[model samples]
Target: MTGTPRRFLVTATPPTTNGDLHVGHLSGPYLGADVFSRAQRMLGHTALYASGGDDHQTYVVTTAQRLGVDPVELAARCNREITGTLELADIDIDAFTRPDDVYRDEVREFFAGLYSAGRLVRRTWTFPYCAETDRYLLEAFATGYCPECLVGTCGAICENCGHPNDAGSLLFAESAGAQEGSTTEPRDVEILVLPLEEYREQFTEFYRRRRATMRPHVLRFVDEMLSRPLPDFPVSYPAHWGIPVGIEGFDGQVINVWAEMLPGLRHMAEAARVRRSPRTPAGVWAADSGFELVQFLGYDNTFYFSFAHLGLALAHGGLVEPTAIVTNEFYHLNGSKFSTSRRHLIWARDLVGKYGPDNVRFHLGLSNPEHQPADFTEAGFLETVRTRLHEPLQALATALAPHTGQPVTVRPETEALLDRYRDRMRRAYTLETFSVRQATETTANLLALLAARAAGDPGLAVAGLRVLGAQAAPLVPGLAAVIESRYAAATPGTVPELADLLPVTV
Candidate 1:
């Protein structure tokens, strides 16, 4: 926080390989992360952006069963889809490794390291189980009235009120494949738990010190949890398809997916090292190397990424503590929470094909839902592209085409505008704050302003639009690279045409 870090790690929420992504997913974390990391690199920082597919989730298994395919096949396909979608959207990602290969061993080692270090608690807990299935219920199969919200709920967390309920507390069990009113009884189970209560004091200190700068909703959630007794977090499930923790007695128990993610970051780093020139020094990405660490995530996941993941990292003894936790509120689609399970969402691949990455990214970047749930309606999307983006792209082209090789002086007002753009760019980037919405909007508004003034003063237009290319290089790198290429041909003071440089159709 005091000085520019020697190394920076920018990570988005690791996506599960259960489904394709929607704009809501991108807008929340990935888009901002991509923009920030790109900007950080542009600023001459040694930044590595890496993420991996979350392949061994209970949700993946559930989805696999519904689709009548092997979980492994499902995970593989979904991982490809996710990586492809990100690539097609021109989202910069260095390493997106699957967990099925060399990564699995490292994940188990991380589990062993934490368990041996006394960070994990092995204990027995009871949960509802149907005798007919000969297995304990875990997620949707374990449906019951949520004690926290008094509403029908499934899984560990209550959507209505973000509380991860104890397995023994859910009421009116509805086991998977069981008929209505079927008698489901309690079954005692042993599992590994991350004792958050024990880590509460340290975590509380960390949270309180950084509370003022954290996202409003996330800070409130961590505040509420720490104010009360921090609950014991579970880290083991009976899922047969995940990494076996190899604990002394818990033979078949697998490490929880959430637990795997914390270490998965390290594995991703290791994999990423191979791809970098001269390679990253061993252990640099694994532990606390005195460099700043940042994690971007959505609203529902703040507790885990902030508290649980941080606890795991610290407990392992030397992983860099998260200096900044950038949390986004949500992106609502048609006033409803965009959900993949319900299939009420726009597919990322389809959106990319239709509008092109820059066009679609413009909508998300401009309307990025940071502190509040930003709505993504079809009508609003078209209007924004028409009024905000398309015109600026067109105007820059027309204004710069004539002055392509001409040098001119910029007015004081236009210079002031450029300064404002740089200030906004600073705030919207990695080191200060990961506010992509603000960055996109500021740049777009400035471009529009320049477009209007272009007719009267072509010098200002040329200078302003040229600067716009520089400022926008982080957010839309693919498109910005094209813009920068055209600007490169300009004779020092000349401008880059938006049309000739940019291949953005419509």
Candidate 2:
């Protein structure tokens, strides 16, 4: 927590508004971004955390169809659910935007600016069409094996390999809603595309300059992408669920939802900035805005945030290039991926309601899938809470309750513990080497250390308790606030009430 104060605009990839968020969703970018932002504030830095519901994804349309409801209505309903879930989980987002008329106009204007600059070009590509359903099979509407990993997946992107599969390019692609044995036919259509191959050299150099700070897995993925020919990214699609392309020829088409992500992020950041400084001018996206951009996303979205989005920023004359890209692998439930279609997952609100938000946050931080896939087993969760958190917290509270207002000099052992804890926090919460799991471990170690020494040296325990209140502020704000408030009111010959510090039942 000892660094030069800086300004950061931290963003989590907007959650798609097709349904309420599951634990897998909370454990990924959302919780990570929250922790990172809180840590930054603890360091006395300016960090604005911004995200919103993605209302334009094609999944919204498909889910709405399955529920026999209008797509717009379904998106609105899910957006409310997502907001409530975030609140329940104690995620402090500066701006959780939902697209309004002004937002729609801004997106169209941004796309048109890129188009007018000749950064986007028209291309003819083959698309899969289902005659029976009268629908185009693209992005959540089609299914097949991935070209790279050969794993069964949906169109547009492969979760297994973190690679993009163009519409109809998947091996043996078929319409998702087709009846048994029914197949899709190929249809050629003209749409606008971004020629990523044109920016290969620039992207290679951009990533090379950032090699030291970027994740190793992400670097490998980027090297693989640059070694092969970069595909021309589609910018427009013939669909009805997103913002209109607003071009003359593409009448019935809308801008691809992925293509709109960069603009959406920009709009959200601008909204946050305006809210923070009402007199600041709007629509300024220069690189010298004095705010560093850092984005958090899942590994499945590597191609978009690192490559496609970077390309777009470069093409627009380098407007707000990300200073850091923090990506996490998928969080699994019981050794299986959480699937909304299969209904095999735990809801965020449900988990937070059962176990308090502080415990849920700590548990998720301990099992965060940063380097590799991690599973959430109920038994493991219970054991971790009981041993790592509940027992240690209870013991510390009991030992400290008797001598709450006693004058205590800082012991040598307590000083050493505080120094090591601060060092660990400094390393774990940084943008270059961020790890929620490490942060959680640091907290657990400090708690265990303090609890083990509580009865022997009451004065040392008191000093360590002060350090714990500050160290746990970012990870468990609610509990930290209670501890800090009670100790802040400490006086000579006063015994504070600390019985409510026990862990909530799971």
- Give the root-mean-square deviation of each candidate in angstroms: 2.3, 1.7
**lDDT per residue, candidate 2, 1-506, as tens digits?**
46588878889999999899999999999999999998888888878888888999988988888889999999999999999999998898888899999888988998899999999999998898898777788888888999999999988999888999976679888887779898778888899888999999889888878886677789889989988999988889877779999988898889889889888988888887776645655643568777778899999999998888888888888587888888899888899998787898999899888888888888999999998999998788888988998888788779877776566556676678688888888788888888899999889888898789878777666666667778777788888888777776777334345556634754
Candidate 1 global CA lDDT score = 0.76
lDDT (C-alpha) at residue 410 in model 1 = 81
Against the reference, the lDDT scores of all candidates come to 0.76, 0.84
Q: What is the number of backbone collisions in each predicted candidate, taken in the order shown?
A: 1, 0
Model 1 backbone overlap count? 1
Runs of candidate 1 exceeding 4 Å displacement: 1-6, 150-152, 399-406, 495-502
lDDT of 1 by residue, 186-294 (tens): 7677888888888877887888787645777877788777777877777887657688877777876788777788888877865655565235666655554544677
Residue pairs in candidate 1 whose N, alpha carbon or C atoms collide under 3 angstroms? 288-318
Poorest 10 consecutive residues by lDDT, candidate 1: 495-504
Task: List residue ranges in candidate 2 displaced over 4 A.
Answer: 276-285, 492-497
